[model samples]
Target: MPWTLPSRPSRRSLLAGAAGVAGAALLTGCSDDRPAGGESGIPLERRMREAAVRDSARLLERYDATAADHPALAARLAPLRAAVAAHSAALALPPAGSRSPSASPTGGTGAAAPSAGGEPVPPKPAEALTALADAERSLSEARTIDLAGAPGELARMLASVAACGAVHAYLLTSTPGATS
Candidate 1:
């Protein structure tokens, strides 16, 4: 007797087999052995938000110190300082029922005033602006890295913040009166 080739599978049979495999995978994937809660169950997002708040506050303090040391640059630096304040406020807001973790107190108004014990003051307006621009650039770069692991909503927010930081750096460096 001659051996005959096996017949091709019908489309319906192929589809049924695929569905059965998928169903089995779905059931197994839902097993209770998976870890619960967010990254390591400690909420990495919350920690990221808190760090953003603290960094923003520190940037604001630095701006204040720079402004106080070079009163001539106060008018020019005001808008940048205001932007940092806004970022700080946004980051400081905790999720429902959660309080913002305490960051270093930004001192009081004029708390960062240039004095013997205060933050070191840059000798020139250009130097201060350069420092601020550098800082903004650094934060923008960090946010780019952070976006990878953040949830959808938080990733969007981080992207926006990163864009804002880049804009701030550009403005600081390209302003008409800014020194080369």
Candidate 2:
């Protein structure tokens, strides 16, 4: 006779399903219906903090890649990269998986980007340090306003991350081998 158990799920199946849902939620948090522009009447400061995470992740990749290309800049950049990575982790932002635009010489639009092979592009450096600088400033300015009414620790963390962004901007701007 075949050995048969109850039809109900065993402990493992229930745990597995819960784990799968949790993983999916983690991966898809960006689309959580948080309105953009604070157009939802949400304050701009809240928006700035969220934007900082996304911008930081993208810039971290670009700077890290560009720094990698120039041997001299790489050592100086290690700490900066580590700081960005830490900030990204704190914000629960995804890591930058895309290759640098410099890597392929295919222009700033790397194969990783969705655009087609040929397109006239602006003169912006493939490295995103400049954009990071802008985002940092925006967040810093927003922090002055009475936004994010509660969650003190989170607000403080965002402020600290914004400061890190300022430092990053200074390093990227003044450091040798940083692209225009």
For residues 74-94, could you state the per-residue lDDT of candidate 1 as single tens digits?
888898788777766666555
lDDT of 2 by residue, 1-180 (tens): 998987999899999998997555434333333445458775443454455555555555555555645555566667877787677556542223523343322222332232233222223443444544454455445542312331344455665776776766676656566688
Clashing pairs in 2: none
- Residue 161's lDDT in candidate 1: 85
Q: Best TM-score goes to which candidate?
A: 1
The residue ranges of model 2 lying beyond 4 angstroms of the native Cα positions read: 1-51, 93-150, 174-180
Error of 2 at 81 (Å): 0.8
- List TM-scores for all candidates, in order: 0.62, 0.42
List per-prediction Cα lDDT, in the order shown: 0.68, 0.52
TM-score of 1: 0.62
Give me the overall lDDT of model 1.
Answer: 0.68
